[model samples]
Target: MSGGKAITCPACGGKIEVRAAGFTVNLACQNCGSLLDVSLPEVVLIRRYKNAKDRFALEIGKRGTVFGQEWEVVGALRRKDQITIWQEFLLFNPYLGYRWLLVADGEWQFGTPLADRPQGDRNRVFWRGENFSRLGRDQPTSTTAVAGEFYWRVKAGDTANATLFQSGETILSREVSDGEENWTQLVPVDETEIENAFGLNRRSLPRRKAAQGLMQFKAAPGMEQDDLGRMFLLAMAISLFAAIAMALLAGPSTKTSSMIQVPVGGQIAPVKIGTITVRRPWQFVTIDADANRFENRWVDLEYNLVDRSSEQSIDAFGLVEHYAGTSSDGAWTEGSHHGDTMFGHVPRGTYDVYVSGSAHGWPVDPAVTDAWGSTETINLTIEASTGAMSWGMWWTLVFALFAWPVSILWWRFRDK
Candidate 1:
């Protein structure tokens, strides 16, 4: 969808495209050296990607049985020239362990066949449901279907013990002493298993069986009563210890010392006035106040007449120069200024104070033609000290009082 009207550059009148990446806007113009503001449209497009690789083509379907259980082909069997790779899907039964097979084929190599063997030698392979021991040995114990090729070395004697047998009556075996011969198998699993293993289930399983299973398990009778008494005793001990600790730690709460005294009838406190001038009509100056020494203090300021003939009263048009203070580190502090008097507690350190006010909200007055009175600046500084309090400690005590009772109740009832 189209966005709002495009902005044109002021100098060159070129069309500009404006797009927002996050909080900021990106703007660029194709034509001239003009500054432009690009408008963003309301609708944007999102894209989705597929899992397949670029070169290989795929066809997906199900395959037949392996080890007497029906198996599925999770993905297409890949083929290039004469080589083929087949992947099989694994089905897991909690009652049974893991089982699956994958196969790869190129041109089979011919080798010498072993001839003589003792008669009456029998080798057989059978299916054994699942092996819980194997499950316990691997952490994150759960049934998962993994797609990969696995190689196993088999010998005639070793083949007799296999859980899965080949389709033929005789079992193929290799010599143990001459190094193991590798037989490779591959298993392809459903892509959905990746999400399932990660607990992202598109469909919810029925909970009836789970509910029945939970119903079969229960705590011993009177266990709750026993647990309750133990919890109560623990609560009493903790409460007693906490009370004693608090009493011991509560020695004498430190009192905030009063402001350093200046001798009676002594010299008026020196005031350091800082001046901030606005260069542009729309710009305002930020005031910084140190609250550490002067928190919740009062400051008196008088705007000295620089050129009285052109001087104008800033308060006349229902607009006063507004000043707001924030902490040195950028925390907002509450303070207020009216006319020439400002009062509030400021935290210690540097502050970013915002100052703005005019007959109109706009910084520049269009009708103000008198050049001498048009350019105005304000000067400010500290005037007097206000009383201080240990606010952090006081608030901490208040929070503790409010929370202690709740904490005690929670401790008493936790086991129940």
Candidate 2:
């Protein structure tokens, strides 16, 4: 509001200019520390900052560039709560009307009014997909204690209040003062950067780092979930494929067997199940037995694998038993109805299985047991296969299934 109007301060007799382009209606006289209202032709005194000290390390009327544009320090205002006081340096550029650099205690933050910007939702504002919430604490009205030339006529005792909201890396602030409402974006700044930006001394003011409110949250990390999710999916697919390939190369298992029968009161002869040829030196072998009697019965067998080339026999055993009972609590089951034994790392050779087994009826008890009084039949089977490839692939498949989700979660949180 440059109407080219000028007035003389009544208290200090200093010439004061007035602008009607904006809502300026008051002015402060620098010479005698008088606040004058020039709304009318005759200037009037409003109030004064009594015995105010020169608090600014960089005084008003200073000119500098900030955020890559030229700006001038038009006015400096000091506001206070009951316990602490902070300062806002008013910066103005002809093209960019106004912005603020706030200094509270030793903390610093750059703030600029969201001037002429389209409004977002008042109830729910989001920036870069981050939702903003009110800080929940109300800012008390702070009266302007000092001032210089202003676009708006600023007088002593003019008060303003600010409400804060947080949106991701930025802080959104709403200021309400002097019947004016404007939203502002706030970014954290350190004392050194502030001084360097404004061309002030490095030790310009006390560096108390008054980083309160939303500024504190800036230290926390941000989540970048998409990257982690992608990495997890890729690793999971590769691991699964490798496991499947390994299991496929393990080849098939080969088996051999024999059958034997013994009658009641007759001698039972140990039988040879059959021979297994190990094509690879470190393959695995398995021995199995199926035994039964006419009466309800179970069988226990002692087995051996004799390598024909080395004449070395491996000692092993197996049991096939079944028992069941019903009680008031519930029905119960015990013992396995099948029996088998596995041997790993068998040297390359032909091997034969020698087995001997005894049968028992259900009427027998553990404390006192007897062999079957009738004939029993038994069948033995021996199988061998390559050990390394099959087991490695199976284990890899199991591990990939278990670890895929964990890899995603682990990086997701780590990134945050």
Q: What is residue 15's positional error in candidate 1, in angstroms?
A: 56
Q: Write the per-residue lDDT of candidate 1 for residues 203-257, one digit (tens) a residue.
A: 3211122323222322233253464455456656665566565444333221111
Query: Residue-wise lDDT of candidate 2 within 1-416, one digit each (tens)?
Result: 12335677777667655433243455666566677666666666877544344456556656766667766665677676433566777776666677888876677778877755434654446655567765534455565466665556665466666666776557888777867787888887767765665666334453344545433322122333454456567777777777676555434556777765533223355777777677665566667555442334466667777889788997777666767778898987777656666676677777787777666657752232246543434433433333345454466666756564565355323422
Off by over 4 Å in 2: 1-8, 15-24, 38-43, 48-54, 82-84, 116-124, 127-130, 153-161, 177-180, 197-416
TM-scores of the models, in the given order? 0.17, 0.41
Residue pairs in clash, model 2: 1-21, 24-153, 107-210
Error of 2 at 124 (Å): 5.1
